[model samples]
Target: MEPTTTTPPEPRSRRGRRPHGKVRRRLAGALALGIGLLSVGALYSVVEPAPQTAVAQAADAATIAKGQDLYNNACITCHGANLQGVQDRGPSLVGVGDAAVYFQVSSGRMPLARQEAQAMRKPPTQTFDPHTQEGADNLAALGAFVQANGGGPQLPAATGEALRGDDPARGGELFRLNCASCHNFTGRGGALSSGKFAPSLDPANEDQIYAAMLTGPQNMPKFSDAQLSPQEKKDIIAYIKSVSDGNNDVGGSGLGGIGPTSEGVIAFVVGLAAIVGFAMWLGAKQ
Candidate 1:
């Protein structure tokens, strides 16, 4: 039939042929590659997590250990080796927090001068003899040690402007109840027993006030956040600011805020002396 062989299907050139075997191999390879990639990704997801560097963990451990040692040696007698505190000697320090410790110890009020009606701030009875170093290292060691044992509020690493409250009314109320007992309603600061006094608030900055409250330096009661609540403390600070602004109408100097007793004494002495001098002059002239 005109070359009836039909050209034998033109010998099916390799280019036109499907090459089924090669196609199957490529498909299998692609599937395997995808599975391998997925398996690797899954394994990585399981193993990797948020990182906590080994150095940080080690430092924290060291700090806790040092704190435990210090508490045992310096604070254990009255506070108890476990920080449960002796029956009447000291209060339990479980959650009192680091702020309390810093305030009392740094201010030289702790390691108490002696057991009395209150613990007073005085020169540190026992100085931190860091036989090894000075400055930050010593402070870090002490701070770490106290922090480990626990007793009071913690000073924030960054006390921003947020530490200074915006609300003065609340600050005033807080000041009256918690601070005014010793500081006076006017924030003039008042006498405690002995030579110790509350001192004037005129010079105190936000940090000093916060530290004073947290530490309760020298015979001052500890005001943990649990006790005073941060909001109340802010209000008290506002009140102190108001009083310190000098709202008095008198044209003369206010001798701090010790009040009329001293003022009256000065007036009597000065005025009476002037009157007597005038009388003597009149008699001499006659």
Candidate 2:
């Protein structure tokens, strides 16, 4: 063969010598990185945190399991096996958290004596008789169960000074808007559609009020932190304390804090007395 040596293949350039597979992989990796960044940006835009969701850490798994068992046995009959509640017997317990359960059971307002207009608070009609330390343990267990199920607001380990806000006036405005219709501007509470009534805030302590707001105990609507900020809640509490602490213009009795009812009664009585006195004076003149 004429020189018999095929001309040496021209030396490939370093850039052009790169393997096709390696090039494809590098391009794929860059594309994946760009897609990930876009996805993160989209997620950041959509997700927002609620204000009052800063609850204490979750309860232990054992406590939750025990609570589930107790719920199944004692509460299932009325609250439903799944905690969805019975049609005519009990309202749904799905979102009602440990705070609600504690308030209802510990206060003896639950395990209702009868299905009535309202389940008023009363002495524990049914006592628990656990063989060992089960009574106290059971209560704790049940609380854990309701808590784990996930629904209502959770109580914090430390309510702290943060629970008390500085703006009572703002609280009053908020109260008028969100709570006045049912609770009355004075926190004296009012009747609802049926025999059920919003109980007076006078008897409710800070924790109790917070719990009620969080859990919506009975027929009340749930107020998640997303709906009302914690600072706002504190302000509401301050307003309640200010109004309930006996600083009103009522002649010392406070008259249950219902302005119209008390004022109407007073005006009616005074007006009637004045009319009678005028009549007597006219008669004397005659």
Candidate 3:
């Protein structure tokens, strides 16, 4: 009691200043924590996603989540929230696997421009191109999300030239037997009934051809491993490449590779023109 009486009252400013300093320190710590959290989130978003060797590769939750986001934004309109597909707009993607996705999307045939007899290839969506890591990551994520919902045909581990086989001769036989009717003997493509047509293979790369065979995009029939062995598929690819690269155009100009009908037409036109000119010359001489 005596000490209390002797002690002067603590200054109001000092008391207030100490409490204010403590409050400032707490606020500063809170701000630092918030910044740290933001930095971590930014880091995660910027990191590159891994590429898949096979479409069946299991995806982590984060990747699936990212894919889900992409689907919701770009695909939900036609493909639906669950990928069941919106009737009259898009087909059900239940059994269509990543192979289909890669074929349709990577080739820019999907996210359809409009209702048509066929989805034609064009420049791919900026996010789906496989040449860039970001595009590849996005494509992988979207494919993963679709695959997670329903497993389907997975792309092979091998890609590019690795998919080519040793025997172009055998490949030519297979191609003639299975693909020539629609794709033409040289893969130049041809008209089908209605508005549909077989798209030319000139623009397609090796992976695209493989994916098309695996998924049977558009009117093309799916060639399962049971129907065509992997080696056989490779051979077919080699044959296609050989023809596509002009290596097999040993007969000179392929004349658009439209086959003998075009050659016959050209021959007839040239012969007709020559005969007409000859007749005119004879009349002039007479």
Predicted model with the maximum TM-score:
3
Per-residue lDDT over 107-161 for candidate 2, one digit per residue giving the tens place of the 0 to 100 score: 5677888888877865542333222365646766787777777566576554534
lDDT per residue for candidate 3 within 46-138, as digits (tens), equals 773434423335446768888889989988889888889998998778888878888889999988898999887888989888889999899
Q: Candidate 1 on 17-81: residue-level lDDT in tens?
A: 56886899999999999999999999987886635456777888887787676667677888887
- TM-score per candidate, chains pooled: 0.56, 0.64, 0.75
lDDT of 2: 0.75
Candidate 3 Cα lDDT to native: 0.87
Summed backbone clashes in each candidate are 14, 1, 0
Arranged by TM-score, best first: 3, 2, 1
| lDDT at residue 145 of model 2 (Cα atoms) | 78
**C-alpha lDDT of residue 45 in model 3:** 64
Output the worst ten-in-a-row residue range by lDDT, candidate 1.
127-136
Q: Rate the local accuracy (lDDT) of all candidates.
A: 0.67, 0.75, 0.87
Off by over 4 Å in 3: 1-59, 260-265, 280-286
Backbone-clash count (model 3): 0
Report residue 154 deviation for candidate 2 (angstroms).
2.1
The root-mean-square deviation over C-alpha atoms between each candidate and the true structure, in angstroms, is 8.7, 9.5, 17.3
